[model samples]
Target: MTPGGRASTAAPAEATATTITFFGGKGGVGKTTMAAASAIGLADAGWRTLVVSTDPAHSLGDAFGTELTDRPRELSENLWAAEPDAEAAVRRRVAQVTEDARSTLPREVMPAVQRHLAHAAATPGMAESALADLLMDAMERVPGEWDLLVVDSAPTGHLLRLINLPELLGPWVEGLVRQRERVASADSLVAGMVGSQERDSADDDPLLARLRERRGKLERAAERLRAEACVRLVLLPRRMVLAETERAADQLSEAGFRLGPVVLNQIPERPDPRVVEAVWRRFEPQGVLELPLAAEEPVGIERLRPLAR
Candidate 1:
């Protein structure tokens, strides 16, 4: 698909099939600019679109010359943009998980539980998990408030982790649910032996309920990502960038995501045809969409339009 052109219709249809397109690459690859330009193109085509930045160091706002928050801000007709605060997202997730534990666990153990949770909040993958949850929320808004969602993700590594969260965490949540079920079963058995009738059913157990809810959400997110989302890696013509993009494409494909066209941004005026040919050869069956280096920086919607074209 060329910038704002209709996304590939090859994806599996859902009851509300809102397409999610992601743009990602190494730092300085102009993915943010590409993402903003793409969103503008979609809006011009009459698709109600919301473009979001999941990168910690957000530049989507700069691209549009507007300040943005986690809430969507209208950029133009049919186009909205937002940059989610990664730190706030992580804190909110920690608070929610802590609240859930507080409601389920005994008061005597609450302090230790909180401590453990605090440590987990500081763990390496916590931020990515929170960001993935935020992305899932955006996905759930499809065809209701917007017809399309565009994500300007972080650098390659973080974006990969964010995209892989559903696949990785779904099974972990399922295991928690099973463990809770076993504990509830044992509790029921003990209560029966003692002739006590205060045991709660598995469905009514707070922890089990929470785990099941999380598992269901993750499962839905995974299905949408694997079946309805397309990831397009934006890259420059440099050798290092090309290498990273190649690896990213392979990883995304192996993770069951549909790889869209690789976007080659900022092509020089006297570009080497050989390098372009090499890129096409490397990514056969996946189109290579090129954007020429702008005479001036494409800062706002009007300047970005020609690049989108």
Candidate 2:
């Protein structure tokens, strides 16, 4: 879809069904620009749209030539923008989990639990989970505050994992909750034998409750993506980008997300037919869309007009 408010020469019919669009590919493929431009186009079409950046190194503001924050800021009529703070999101999630655990675990052991949680929050997957949370939040607000939502995703790996999280983490979370329940049962048995006061029952375990809550959120997010969202892989004509896009497509297919179309951004004036053919043969996307190389850098909304259509 053209990001700029103009009709795309590629696909017109498909645009009507897409309310949430994810622009993702290898880094430097101009996915952020395309996402921002698409949001502009959607808004210009009279659809209230919010374009959000899940990339930790956000460039949506750079594309629009404006500063942005974690909160949604109005860019123009019917268009808004946001960049969720990944680090802060991670910290907040960890804090919630820790607080819930503190209600169950002994006070003396809470300090060590906090330390372990801090380390766990530093892992790579945590950032992706935080971004997933932001994406889910945006999707849940659809048709309420905005008619359309556009996501400028992180580089290929993170984006793929973020989309695949619910499937991968569902069982793992269930297993953790089960193990915690077993431990709680054993602790209760020991307290009874020792005539010590039993702290609480597993029925009221806060950590287990939190785990179930998180799992439920992820399940709903996965359902929203599968049922409502369309994923578009953006790429340049370079060999590396083509190969990466192919891999991304395969992963998306495996994860059960419907692939929308392949967007070829920044096409040169003298395009290579060979490069185009190679992508068509190997990428095999449902549809293909192209954006011409701009005469100058596409910075502001005016410069992005040609692409929007």
Candidate with the greatest TM-score versus the true structure: 1
**Cα lDDT for residue 213, candidate 1:** 73
lDDT of 2 by residue, 175-219 (tens): 998998888889889999999988575667888877888888888
User: Which digits, one per residue and each the tens of the lDDT, describe model 1 over residues 196-296?
Assistant: 98577565677778777777787787777787888888888777778878898888888787888888888998877777777888876888898888788
Worst 10 residues of 2 by lDDT: 1-10
lDDT of 2 at 227: 69
The TM-scores of all predictions, comma-separated, are: 0.88, 0.85
Clashing pairs in 2: 3-37, 3-38, 3-308, 4-308, 6-309, 7-309
lDDT of each: 0.81, 0.81
Worst 10 residues of 1 by lDDT: 1-10
Q: TM-score for candidate 1, please give it.
A: 0.88
